[model samples]
Target chain A: MFYDNEMTLSFRAISSNEAFARVSVAAFALQLDPAVSEITEIKTAVSEAVTNSIIHAYDNGDGIVHIWCGCAGNKLYIEISDNGKGIENIETAMEPLFTTKPEQERSGLGFTIMQSFMNNIEVSSELGRGTKVTMEKSIGE
Target chain B: MSVGFKTLNNCLIVEIDGEIDHHFVDNVKKSIDSQAVQKGYSNIIFDFKNVDFMDSAGIGMIIGRYKFTKKNGGITSVACLSDNLKRIMMVSGLYRIIKIYNTVEEATKAV
Candidate 1:
């Protein structure tokens, strides 16, 4: 049950738009009165989620990446979804330092960073369908 | 982001401005690599006073450069990080490989 309002945004799946997506959501999260550390953590989580959508989801092709953010009390909820190729092994994908695109110098810490900084994270995907990442954080805590 | 380079005591000091994310990482890497490699500096120092935001991509960028310099028997150090970024770096385990300093002068002097 969301106590506060929500906002959603969608942008093309491109590297340039990754920063925009993260920053936009972080800006939208300002209403929660997040500390600097909280904002940075949220931005980092958004960056990882959006970058995953751009690189692994669409294979760096043209597609759409969507972000939804809302505040409920002192909690912040964010979901980043993409309509592209889904992960084959989410268990492996979530492993620390596990990256599918090592050739591109991917650190494989995207999911780990998000998991580390957020209070809760859930990933759901189906091959040939898409991937959705929903995460929650205690903004004012 | 704008990257400025300065030479000090056979070390390359890179001043990084603006945010570092997946998008700007390639440019940041290439620019720093060209100078660090061509000059054959014995060490490199990255100044992050102006950086506002960074992610795992920035970690990769720094590690890649660290490997390049280390492969050449050179050292690397970083200076001036916001508290938030420092926390991220600690979680990423960068402190094990890269030395952190309070300022560019300190990094250049020590490295």
Candidate 2:
């Protein structure tokens, strides 16, 4: 089935923009009229993905992060991409409590939270190219 | 990024206001850690009365504090959590380790 509604947002990979990206996705997903819990789930998952891009991608430098959200029927689809240093070991990165920036208080639970909140999540990356994460959740489930 | 700290009898009650995400979870951790560990506090009560929202980053921040307090033989508890915050923490299994009370006073009493 095709998306009944879709929106794309592009912003600088900055820590401050994390909140903007989360709220923007949440607002767009609101079109599905999800429950309060569903809304929070999307907001939290989006925040985690956007934060990872800002922290791991740009590494305090500069880059672009793109977020795309769409809804069809009761399913919400989200994609967050960044053009920066990509993950070396996708499996290791997805492991619970595995964070490269341990000294920075990173619990390495970003992907864990996303997977737990959403129905599905896919992470694709290239060593020197970039990374893209796609996730989806069904409302009222 | 404001956290109000009230120290009472070696217990620190933190009033966490505003939305908590990666944007300010670091500051929250720093502020609470300084007061809990450096100030020699034995119990930490996170008063989430004003916390509007919290993402996974908040969970990480709380875990970091929990670990720090554990090393010092301190107790960690939460109070006044919004429904959203409570659900997020619950799904992350935070309630299993940290006790949640309806009020800061209740948490302190149990401590």
Q: Every model's DockQ, to 2 decimals?
A: 0.78, 0.67
Candidate 1 deviant stretches above 4 angstroms? none
Off by over 4 Å in 2: B37-39
Model 2 chain B lDDT-worst window of ten: B26-35
Superposed by TM-score, candidate 1 places the C-alpha of residue A37 at a distance from the truth, in angstroms, of: 1.6
Residue-level lDDT of model 2, residues A1-141, one tens digit each, is 588999999999888898889889999988888898888888889999999998997786799999898899989999999989999999999998799998887778889889988999999999879999999999987
Least well predicted 10-residue stretch by lDDT in candidate 2 chain A: A101-110
Q: Over all chains combined, what TM-score does candidate 2 have?
A: 0.93
Q: Is the docking of candidate 2 incorrect, acceptable, medium or high quality?
A: medium
The CAPRI classification for model 1 reads as medium
- Model 1 chain A — which ten-residue stretch has the worst lDDT? A99-108
lDDT of 1 by residue, B1-111 (tens): 688999988899998898888898867788788888788785889889999888999888888878888888988888999997798789888888889899988887786
